[model samples]
Target: MSPILLTEDLTMTYHVGKVDVHALRGVNLSVAPGEFVSIMGPSGCGKSTLLHILGGLLKPTSGRVIVDGEDLAAVGDAQRTDIRRRKIGFVFQRFNLFPTLTADGNLRLAEHIHGNHRSKAELAELRREVLGLLGLEKKLHHKPLELSGGEQQRVAIARAVINRPAIILADEPTGNLDSENSEIVLDMLVRLNSQFRQTIVMITHNPEAAAIAERIVEMRDGRIIRESQPDRGAKRG
Candidate 1:
């Protein structure tokens, strides 16, 4: 299968006051369809920046970001935004949900913004499938505050994949949860990969969390230091 996401020599720089903070310096990665890949690094590493660029949320200072065959740099900002909405799913560490909206409402909001809103029947059908898949069918009417942190995160994941994106970009998805909650969330992600063949590129800082992936790529000082098919070796943080 063709790579669902690819980056070549990606870089990003930030001007923090008078200092130049190089967030990313020539990073590279490729993720195939139906595969789960994790990027792990220290706090200052550019793993999240790589994900943002891959998702087209942030423009790269220089390099190529090709997702589902479209070169992002080739598209205008408006087109890039459309592609991000339609083709890529994003799950962040903080569950970015509107507290006032019910879980179902949040999912509907995504559909409306995507410009291909589903009919009531279509949305209900999709919601049933997704909620069943995420084991969240019962919590659809609950607002964010009524649910646990892990449950809210699951809702966020359901929202992301409601459109059947070509790739899912997860940044520290389990960062806020306790070990038990983290396991629950991670297990769902693994099941999503195993059962539906969802393509995933996740950034994590924890060795245990990163181990859940089929492969782990380590980043240091803004570049890929090494990659391990740790289906075998000692896991790294």
Candidate 2:
């Protein structure tokens, strides 16, 4: 099977005054469908920049990004936005939920924006399943401000998966929570991946967090330096 996400010699550069800051240098990555991969790096290592480029939020300065068959680097702004909406779901350190919308409402808004062909009843069932898997079934009526940090992040995760996008891009998903809540959120992510075969590419600074993935990729100074699999007992064929 072809890789759902692919990057070939991906590079990004920023001009600061007279200096050229290299954010990425010749990054080549491939993620199989239904696989979970984690990226780890120190600050300014270019992991975040790679994620942004993969998500189509930033155009690469050179090379190609092929997500679910579409070349993001070659697309125009509108086409890139469309592909992002159709194939990618993003989770960040900050829970970017709507302040005024309840948990369910936020999910519904995402569903509306994606505008899929799922029937109303099917959509509702999917939403309920995603929320239930994330342990947000009871918190659906709560708004962002009313929920705990973990609860809000769970809601964000649910919103991201409600439409069953081809891939999820998570950047430091547990960065804001305490240890207990971070564990809870990570467990929920594991459950989602195992049950739904959701493909995920997560960028994290925590080694423990990166260990949960099927494969761990380490980066430094704008390049991938190492790759390994965590000793989490059994591998998921």
Residue pairs of candidate 1 with colliding backbone atoms: none
How does model 1 score by TM-score? 0.93
Question: Cα lDDT of model 2 overall?
Answer: 0.91
lDDT of 1 by residue, 1-237 (tens): 778888888889988899988999998788888889989989988888888999999898888989889999678899899889988889999999999999989998888787675687877787788889888888989999999999999999999988767788899999999999898888888877776778988898888888888899999989999999765244212
**Each prediction's TM-score against the native?**
0.93, 0.96
Q: Write the per-residue lDDT of candidate 2 for residues 31-83, one digit (tens) a residue.
A: 99999999999999999999999999999999999999999999899999999
lDDT of 1 at 127: 71
Give the per-residue Cα lDDT of candidate 2 at 120: 86
